[model samples]
Target chain A: MTIHHQSATQLTRIICAGDISAYEVTTASLEQIQAENPNLNAAITICAEKAQAAAKRLDESIGRGEIPGPLAGVPIVVKDNLCTEGVETTAGSHILRGHIPPFTATAVARLVNAGAIIVAKSNLDEFAMGSSTEHSAFGATKNPWDHTRVPGGSSGGSAAAVAAGWAPISLGSDTGGSIRQPASLCGVYGLKPTWGRVSRFGLIAFASSLDQVGPFARTAQDLAAALQVMAGHDPHDATSTAYATDALNTALEKDIRGQRIGICPEWMSGNGLSTGVADTVSHAIEVFEKMGAKIVEVTLPKTQEALAAYYVLAPAEASSNLARFDGVRFGVRNEANTLPEMYKSTRGTQFGDEVIRRILLGTFVLSDGYREAYYRQAQRVRGQITHEFESAFADCDLIASPTSPVIAPLIGAQTDPLAMYRMDEFTIGANLAGLPALSIPCGYSDSMPVGLQLIAPKFREERLLSIAAAYERHAGQPGVAS
Target chain B: MPDITSDDVHRLAELARLTVDSARVETLAAELSDITEYVQVLRSVTCTVTPSPHAMSSVRKDEVNPSLDREELLNAAPHSDADGFIVPRVVG
Candidate 1:
């Protein structure tokens, strides 16, 4: 049967039943990546040889009577920001054009150990900086549904790759809607776990407090399966804590008959929601009501500050984390007569205009004179936003909103850069508060997908998944492009 | 707003330890001022003190862990030699 782009859960069932060998699956995935990627530019790097080798290894294990691990033989792509051994890990930046990670990221290792094959490294905005994948120095990853439009980013390529059948499942990092926004813009399922739930040891940091590794898949079940493997603690990542991921797995069995889904009023009042975006979300709220979910209209008053605080806080932390890329150590470095000159020249020359703008802005915000005025102020407001979410959750089980203000924008549509940043309006608040959030395809407009976002309190991913699964099961399931 | 002057932009650039393209500095200066003005909206909110937002409070127990080897760390470098990544001269 045509299992191309089917959920990994669905595909694995077939593999277990012996309908297709892992080799067949892997080769199909490779061919899909090759055929589809050129039109979309979703892949920044492909590993055809290694993928074949990995598929062969899986096939031998199955022959030897070894139990195919969970998600056995499913192919997945990863955002380039995650470190993977033997593959170049440039986060769509000229600075790290050909840099490789000698040791694999824990998330990658977990997926590999679970018998999943790596397909390719997907494109992204430089250093995970922009809402559109357009900022990539390598090249923009276009939305699969409409090539003229941007694939929402910095995980746009990850989301778009899954939507386009290049990979059934993929990994994306969400510092501030880096996963969900793209997953929304491209019709797919993306989940950002509560902070510290997933190990971040090898995720190249965009912002320390906000960065989270999440799974993007064609279906919620597939997302849950991927997260079950990738979530948990690594002593290597001090911020990541240990957890029994069975909570997420068990969520599928949780009854969502009487759950209270929060209809956040802040979403309705927001300025940028397109007619398409609002209609899709309104339809979702109606579905929740019909499924016996008590819908409560909730007010998160401080949410107005979410956008401003995210920009300030994410950039402030990014300025520090990205300092390692100077010519003194790794990645691209232009030689100069002096060491100081080399550091300046390398970054100034290699980094893109958007990345440079961020560095300068971050440098200024965190500067000695401006620290109290900008950085400290942002921290205080971040606290307020967090408190606002906590208070809102006191009356609701899952907070719901539109993942993006609109479907993917046309590539380079806005002349002003700050106007482009405004597209992240709906999803950034969850990141600021360190909450678990998911984006599931709800409806379509102009043949592009819109996502209905469900957020839960810290580490409450299982319940969030339960709500999403119930919705997906009834609403024709997520991942089908309209 | 600070009504930031050209000298202020030059000084901030110096403190940031990079040279700003002089041509772009004026436009950037205006944008920064607007952003800084916009961010002033936060000053009105009073927050009850919380030490830090981190959920895990106690220090993580120090323990032995397997780290990426020297070769692994050096693999990310753009310019490396037998000893390690080569640089122009830190001790100028």
Candidate 2:
């Protein structure tokens, strides 16, 4: 069962039935990412000779007959903030340490044109601000179930390289709750989508309207086949969403009877949840009320002003999309001698300290007497949290909640900064209302992992990945990391 | 709700060109005044809704594409060569 514990839809159906050979499952996923990325440091650029030369050219174009696609040779990873053309991509920041990216990242070029293979480059938090990836400057990733916790993060190295099996699927991004809070602290199945349902061109910018990029599987049909090969529309991401996406592996054999499913009740009687994540989201809403859905409850009533309007509209759009890392165009420049000391000594020694405290609280909420008191009252409390998720999806069809209200702390537990921005109180109201959520893993507390989020609306995402593949087939799998 | 001093972290590290280390400007003026007093709860939440902005604009077809490769982005800049990228001397 190796090949890094199967799943990219079971290694693209046994490498399209040749019984195995996408170069022997990309050489057993580059030998389980070189024996589990040094005990789960969940990758930071280990493209083993460009993923064994793209799995030996998808095993010589499937022995000269072709036909593969739909993620053929599988293997994956991504998330060093997308753009991967010659790799380096450091969004986990050191002012783009040894830059590189001369392109590629229309969702990692639609998962390497649907035949996967990337193989490495995870780590995040620096430019993705933080929720722990211990604000990565290329370090903290742990939590392959618990190496003193913290795998939850700005896509904590693509959810600890898909819960340590070293990639069955990966890609990461999601602005607030960087990929479902590190795929709910590395248990797996993350999602996010919907915002512009996937295309963010090269992805680097932090809060470009609460980013998107998605995927991080461990099931739910390899997160709906890596969201049907990284969802659609591109023309280099002019906020994508031109449409035609739904084909989530043919809505994973539908089944959410009588649907409904809302929940919320001020997110399960609030107060920063955690009673084993509100009894594992009330046993995943009583296993979706024993598979006939309905649940109800609702009332998003401005889900507590979505973590204070996503910390003032994602640090006022990450200080205007990181005023393009000045140090003369790209990265590493610092020698200074005016030009504003080379943009303050190359982003003050290649940013960190929570990206220079969110670019000085996003240049003090877009300065000039605090733009109508903090970025237009956090864009009118982000249009009342997108009209309370459009009036709770006008009476529910998907909501759930509790992606992270607790669990996975340990790794230097909360070193303030508003206690690490309340570790994105239950995933920043679906990235401040752009919607389509997901997460999954629902169960386990002191023994970590909990997640269960869901969400939906806006580009429905094939009914949010067929209700997370019918609650991941009645909450079974989710364990891995051995 | 004022507080973040050290001259507002030296005018927000001089409008975020960012360089603040006077021993971390009194701990970034006490963590930017505890995150601007916790995002002043979005200025007491009285939203009369209007903000829209969620980016779904599209537009294309203004022609002229194929760009990128000015000598491989001027050999990834940091003070490039061949008539480009070496900034600093803003006109005499």
- Best lDDT among the predictions, by candidate number: 1
> What DockQ, between 0 and 1, does each candidate earn?
0.50, 0.31
Q: Residue B68 CA error for candidate 2 (Å)?
A: 34
Chain A TM-score of each model, in the order shown?
Answer: 0.97, 0.39
- How much is B5 displaced in model 2, in angstroms? 18
Which digits, one per residue and each the tens of the lDDT, describe model 2 over residues A1-482?
66657788778888888888887777787787788788677677888888888888888898898898988888888888888887788888888788897888888887788898888888877877887788888888788887888887888888888887777788888878888977887778888888887788888888888888888888888788777777777787778766676566678789879989888777775667778888877888898889898888878855456887788778878877888897787778787667887898788778888888887888888888878988888877877878878888999888887888888888887888787688677788888788888888887887878888888888887787777788778767786865
- At residue A449, give the lDDT of candidate 2: 83
Error of 1 at A257 (Å): 1.9
Question: What's the true lDDT of residue A364 in model 1?
Answer: 76
- Per-residue lDDT tens digits for candidate 1, residues A1-482, read 34656679877778877787888888988997898788789999998999989998988888888898888889999999999988999989998988887877888889989989998999999999998999898898999888899989999889888888777899999988999999999988889999988888788988989999999987778888988888877766777877667788778767787888887776865577888888888898888888888888787745447777776778778767877888666677788877777777777778777776777677778877778877888888888778878888999888888888888999878656667777777788888889999998888977788888889998899987887888877886655342
CAPRI docking class of candidate 1:
medium
For TM-score, the strongest prediction is: 1
Q: Return the interface RMSD of the candidates, in order shown, one decimal each.
A: 2.4, 9.9
